[model samples]
Target: MNASEGLWSHLTGGALFWLTLTLVVYTIVDRLSLLARRNPLANPVLHSVWVIGTILVVSGTPYETYFDGAYFIHFLLGPATVALALPLYENRRVVLRSLVPIVAALAVGSAATIGSVIVCAAIFDLPAMITISSLPKSATSGVAMGISQSVGGDASLTAIIVVATGIAGAVMATPLLNFLRITDRRARGFALGLAAHGVGTARAFQVHPLTGTFAGVGMSLNGLLTAVLVPLAASLIGG
Candidate 1:
């Protein structure tokens, strides 16, 4: 028992410390990126992930061992997601008024996003697993990976694709909205969230308080719906 405790402390003491140390690196790099007029679409999370991921690979540490200690930080994600509801509740009146439009947008946007990705994959002759993994690219990583895994796709690939799609969406959502003359803040927020997931929600928050609230709603709702839809869609396509 004592030996096991010592081993745990030894492994986690330095590598597990990476999570905390990464935050400082993230903050400094984020500020520098912003000062250099870097695009917010190039989020600090993305950069920090690359840096930390490389470090993990080089150190030859196993993920399960590291995760044992880092899982506490991940636990906060649920609460953070729940807190988004507060902003939505504060904007309840506007949300109620726009419920129909929001639902309509979600359906159309969801279908378009899914259909186009599947079609593009078909045209490119991408592998079946790759196509399946890409289907949920617009949803949150946790939900998207589950959706992919349920359909026999690669969860790691799903995460990568989801992150890439989100970064692309976050970087382009505003410009795309402008080009399409999507001037309504609610619409922009909803579109951003539906298409970009967390990164888009973050971008929406920068636009306005109300926009951020709507984006959070859209992100959560789309995640729920996509979790249901992507599997069904994949089955149908395979059939």
Candidate 2:
């Protein structure tokens, strides 16, 4: 092979190329988002997913091949999840005061989120496995995969559902909140994170620190609740 052609093939085939390309593309979109007055519609995660997905489709890169290169970024999800506690701790007063309500809301929200999906899927005559898998779509993607496994659901499908759920919530958050007159940043953040998980948390950070902090709490709490409740509910139903 010619030197330039060989080098191009080598770079594209390497993990560094895919990983760096992902980050650089995401960064550019994030900056564009900011330039657009931080428009909610111009979300970085939404755009990044679109751009990367398009690239993969165009390049004929198998999902597995892309994931192999991107696994390092995926590995950091655990650390990022644990780091969510810091913000929750920073707002410990709010957490402490609303502990009862937080727990109560989580229970109801988790149940409703899972149950609603199941019901909708049933009405549409979706396969049982798909319905079960989608139950954890509101949780963080990693946790959703685990829950999907436990519930005999498809992990890959759950991952896609989780991202779709996040993008839907992130895009609708501003308009919905304004319409509902939900002016409290903390409340908005919490609702978004509860509904959207990490993607929503990122969007919250773009809005304000306080918003992001509460979003962190909601994201973590909702994930914890769904992780525990979903499998148990599946068992109860399956039994």
| Every candidate's lDDT | 0.82, 0.86
Residues forming the 10-long window of minimal summed lDDT in candidate 1: 12-21
Question: Please, what is the TM-score per model?
Answer: 0.85, 0.93
CA lDDT for candidate 1: 0.82
lDDT value for model 2: 0.86
Candidate 2: count of backbone clashes, pairs at least 3 residues apart or interchain: 0
RMSD values for the candidates in order, in angstroms, are: 4.1, 1.7
lDDT of 2 by residue, 2-68 (tens): 9998897787677888889888998999899989988889988889998999998997777777787
On lDDT, the candidate that comes out on top is 2
Model 1 regions lying over 4 Å from their true place: 1-15, 33-38, 58-69
Q: Which pairs clash in the backbone of model 2?
A: none
Candidate 1 backbone collisions, by pair: none
